[model samples]
Target: MKKLPHKFQIPLTVAIMLPIMLTAMPAVMLYSTLPKGAALFEPWLDTVTRMVPFALPTLLVIAGSIRFVVTKWLVQPAPSL
Candidate 1:
């Protein structure tokens, strides 16, 4: 399989990860936070709306930082022939 180009990688990763995280995180948190028999729709939507703006840039920055550090310092070069 072909790898995505470097230019496309962060955006693609965010696009995929964001929706999954956004949907799953709030549902789990609300399930625990909301009282039994309480409605979830309004709270869930509210959480999503409130969280997305913060989460996107945070996730993007984290991913980019990790990629930079790993490629810069952690990954070793291929052995010479």
Candidate 2:
């Protein structure tokens, strides 16, 4: 299979992370907050819709910041021979 170009990395990351984060986080939140057998699908859908606009930008910014910090300060330099 052909690999995607490097330019596609960020967009691909967002595409993959978006659904996983959106589904998992809201499900967990609703599961804890709603009553048992209190009808989850509608509320989970509602929460996901409400979260969509904010989620992408937030994910990008946070991921970029962490990547920057890790590369800048957290990673160790190779030891000299």
Candidate 3:
């Protein structure tokens, strides 16, 4: 098997993140559709609501930082012939 390229390492990580983004939609929809407004604070639905807003931005920031750093420093400059 061909060893993965160093440049592919970061991109592979970013690509793995795509499925998590896809799952968030259904997760949010399920949260909204559930009749949790009348329920107390300890339910699983409440956890989803509280956690997603707090966590999503943090995730975005982390991923963005990784992308910025890799693009800025890790990628090899084109070799001048």
Candidate 4:
């Protein structure tokens, strides 16, 4: 398979990882906090369905802002010998 350009790397990574993290984190949290043997499947499915639309854009904005800040303000100068 052909590799994508360097510029696509971060965005592609975020796209792939964010959904997995979002879904998995919620499942872990809900399972731990909810009563044992409580119905899990329906609530998890509903939460994921309702949460994705709002969470995706909000997280994208946050990720973009953090990327901008790190690139803009976190650059290091060449060290002198």
Best by TM-score: 1
Local accuracy by lDDT, each model: 0.88, 0.89, 0.69, 0.85
Candidate 2 vs 4: which has more TM-score:
4
Quote the positional error of residue 31 for candidate 4 in Å: 1.2
Q: Check candidate 2 and list the clashing pairs.
A: none
lDDT of 1 by residue, 17-58 (tens): 878988889999999999999999999999999998998789
lDDT of 2 by residue, 6-78 (tens): 8799789878987998888999999999987799999999999999889878877998999799879999866
Better of 2 and 3 by lDDT: 2
Off by over 4 Å in 1: 1-14, 77-81
Ranking by TM-score: 1, 4, 2, 3
Clashes found in each candidate (C-alpha, N, C closer than 3 A): 0, 0, 0, 0
- TM-score, candidate number 2: 0.63
Q: TM-score of every model? A: 0.74, 0.63, 0.43, 0.70
Cα error of candidate 3 at position 5, Å: 19
Looking at model 1, the pairs that clash are none
Q: List the residue pairs that clash in candidate 4.
A: none
lDDT: worst 10-residue window of model 1: 9-18
Model 4 lDDT per residue over 7-62, tens place = 79888987899879878977987899899889888888888888889997898799
**Where does candidate 3 stray beyond 4 Å?**
1-42, 77-81
